[model samples]
Target chain A: MHAPADPAPLPGDRRHPGWIAWALLAPMVFWLAAFVVVPAAILLVYSFCERDEVGGVVFRFTLENYQRVFDPVYLRIFARSIGYAALTTAICVVVGYPVAYTIARASEVWRHRLLLLVMVPFWTSFLIRTYAWITILKQEGLLNGFLQAMHAGGGPFNLLYTPAAVVIGLVYAYLPFMILPIYGSAEKLDNSLIEAAYDLGAGPVRAFSAVIVPLTMPGIAAGTLLVFVPAIGMFAITDLMGGAKVPMIGNVIQNQFLQARNWPFGAALGVVFMLMFVVTYGLLQRRGARLAG
Target chain B: MIEIRGVTKRFGSFTAVDNLSLSVRAGEFLTLLGPSGCGKTTLLRLLAGFEMPDEGVILLDGQDVSHLPPYRRSVNQVFQSYALFPHLSVRDNVGFGLRMQNVPAPEAAARVAEALEMVSLREQADRLPHQLSGGQRQRVALARAIVCRPKVLLLDEPLSALDAKLRHNMQLELKHLQRRLGLTFVFVTHDQEEALTMSDRIAIIHRGRIEQLGAAGEIYHRPRTPFAADFIGQANLLQVAVVGRNGTTARVRVGGGLELTVASAELPAGARTALVSIRPEKICISKQRLDTENLFEATIEEEIFQGATDQLRLVTTQGTRLHALVANESAMQEAFHEGDRVYCGLHLDDLVIVQAE
Candidate 1:
């Protein structure tokens, strides 16, 4: 038998001379240094420093900011933020999978049209869309007005400025992120594999659970990360939809930076939040690779 | 036993299978042999219940299953691409059908092991489909389908994906396995040689219809239609003018006004235009004139050196071309070269009259 050949190198693998690669990557390197590396370095320095009485960061080295981030009040906010993000991710998956599968299995023309519908929301500004949701969900908004006009029992129930409204806003904003990746996986799934399952006497449910689910796990994983990571740090939606009534980790971090005027404490919270994302993403990536293998 | 009666399947404007009817005997290996788009694969899919026939009934052992879903059918298929579940181990794939049937764990394991052993793949039972070679994956697919032990097994050109030599080996292995299992097989293929070597009976399909169906020997030796004659094997289908009919034979005038007699039970009554099929190997080429009534002098146009035989392209004096194959057993006996003048002899029993259409 012939030995298995080595896998071909990925496109990102550097095959050119060192100088040429550095030249090609110069612009991206400069951008990352200016935007990402520089900001991260500044945040790291601020996290370990002291804040002056007037809210300007002092040069004296200190660890009190990191200690203050783990206090009960801030920890509770972090937990609530995770709870909301986790719930949003779960609902997105439950709602997005069937829509993605339907679009993937549609004929070529319809598939394009449905995908366009999914993406059309992204063309407008996100903040404008959130304001639009505010218009619809507020008391005496279109939905409550229509219900009252139809003589429904409940009149002007508190719909906006609630946790449910926050979730609705998050789901609306991140649904396409959940769908597009799953659509990609579902579209490439071989129809013959499903037929083979049926031929082997598997019922529709069993075939889907056993064969289809494992194959599309990569897409689900990617969608989960995309929906979960950004939703955790989203402060604008809670302020607009939840009316800033309840504080999430994002609101606390934002208040420290702007309202409370404590840049060091805010930088500490940001560093911890960034570390949590790295750990979660690393674990998810390992699990995804295992599923694919 | 499987019966497909007057089944018709249409895709939009194209009729994939048109009023086709066929019966497969129990425990026999029957092949649907045809070129691509001739509805052979579509017919196999109909039997497998992957496609429902638009117009007829498919009976499995006397029960009509025309509208039954594939999971409810008693037929299994080995797809051309193998279609093995990539996430499952070979053992799991082979046991999937049994698991669906709710077989006991111990029994399913034993049966899966036996099936893997039958395919000589027990050692690789733990490997995933991606880890296996192409031939091994094909064997896993075979084992997976057969482990279910359905009444009829449909193979849709399963060997077409392999290389030539591997396909040859798998053909013999599959034929042997079918005999040992004593299960009915409805195999579909476009390879004529594979059909001839592996099938107990061959059905030649053309344009969504069966032109001929018989044993391999009968199909090769006495093809009833010009399509079957030209498709199954290499044949020189000469257009002949019928001179007269005598009993079951007819005398026809062929190339360069050369008169020949052929079997004519298939010819239409009072037909003047006829076609006769003659295998190249049946024609004899000699330097000296043979003492036969069916002999004509021709000049060799080209000599093609096949591995086991020499093919000579001969043209009669009146410019009618004929091909003759001489076995290369002896150098002296097969010494015909290009441009050499020779006499070509034809036997009465070697010619078959076929329909032009």
Candidate 2:
């Protein structure tokens, strides 16, 4: 079928109306400047200034705050945060891929219903949901009691306030983020391609790896960015589930502002964290571009 | 070689393929020709093992593979959409089957190159499917399926996606490819001319049943059923009553007392009347009186100027309407105008009776 040609420009409209475009974009530009850009600019300035003893930002410039951010202890936390985020991302992919694929390929009525189920969790407050995890993972909580009742394990097992619990919380929170993007890609996949794969003598697994997975890589990459970037900087889950025993970069950054009363140091850590997200996003985008090319 | 016996496929309540039996001779290009939803595609899917027949067995080279999955069967399909892997390079897509079969890497590479060369797409080997044109992607799909060297290749309207000019070229190319490879081809299409051009045998399907199956010429000239007669080519169906029968030819009366001679072979024994098919091109319209057994005095009612031929709509003196396709020669084009009196002649050999419905 022939694509409709673009409509010809109206008479006397050879030049773009620059003022209308600017007027339409004004609100978004104002919002970004007021909230994101101005706050980021303030943080950048604060990162080079000192904090007074009275828990107020001092205008005196100093390199000490940024130097503290590079210390071995904070660096270790940064590495650990990356490790946790990577693990969370891997688990999200493994768990979310099949669910997303199933939902995507489901019959139309069921596909919408299943997607609604994935999003149903979002109607509740996120903090309330994180606390709900506490009720399930505590020593005498629903999980340990169920395990005990089933005779699958011997004791309450110190399940809460652990790294495993923290990971479980992180995965639960971000799994839908992984599922939605992957679903977007998988839903657009042509059924004939899968049939062609089978006709070409590739079994189900072979077809999945050779055709389906690569075709859906863009979604997986998008989901990874959605899950991984936020997971690395997430402080609440680690605090509520890890019981603040181990500090991720997010927890340290949070403690600097709230408990340590070190605004300059917190701003420095925030700057570094934002830079890492930029780098991670850039690498993922480049990988996606390479795959497309 | 392929043999299908009493296969039936149903999608819920809708029967896509009725109990159908067909056989393809070794290396023959057999086309399942039908309009959409006539079960031609379903039958092709049944052969490819994409859809299992609920009621029958399929034999591929004498082995029963009715319930086997597509990957287990030694068959490949060139999809109508040319379902080449968008993420894979042309070389990779072509080599995918070999890789799954666990052929040696070197042999797989060599075969992929050979298949690409067969389609004259060696230059596009490293490019993704999206990088190529529609025709190039179709070639890649062909290469991919052929590299496996399956006993049978199923093509689901592969050329339907191309423009008319390119489709004609690919029809010849596909015919040559099937010949060179010596593989049995089970093709499906709604296009009548495509089926006639490429198939060694054509199975005219209607509502999941084979109405008629024969070589292209036999199907065109002697369609057993009215559906087949009308589907393949333009045929003027005349309702006639048999008045008398000689040993070989029968005299049949058309509307308002026009008698025509038809071969007795077309009439069932003791049948009083029959529906007969006459190709439009078979009717001769001339200014001079014609010396034929079945001749009628007619008036040219309308003339349609087709590029190669001018179609003359004629009304006999007895008020029977018929269409005659005459060559578009300069003299003929000007000779047959609306309201001109002419003699319309039909040959006995051109009139064949076909089954109703």
Top candidate (DockQ)? 1
lDDT of 2 by residue, A201-274 (tens): 88999889888999999999999999999999999999999999978999998998999999999999999999
**Tens digit per residue, CA lDDT, model 1, B64-172:** 9998989999899999999998878889999999998889999999999999989888888887788777788889899999999999999999988888888888899
Best by lDDT: 2
lDDT of each: 0.90, 0.91
**C-alpha DockQ of every model:** 0.50, 0.46
Model 1 TM-score, 2 decimals:
0.95
CAPRI verdict (incorrect, acceptable, medium, high) for model 1: medium
What's the C-alpha lDDT at position B144 in model 2?
Answer: 91
Task: Give one digit per residue, the lDDT tens place, for model 1 in A1-293.
Answer: 22232233343565656998899999999999999999999999999999999999998999999899989988988999999999999999999999999999999999999999999998999999999999899896998988999999967889899999999999999999999999999998999999998988889999899888888888899999999998999999999999999778888889999999999999999999999899989999999877765
Clashing pairs in 2: none
Q: Give each model a TM-score.
A: 0.95, 0.95
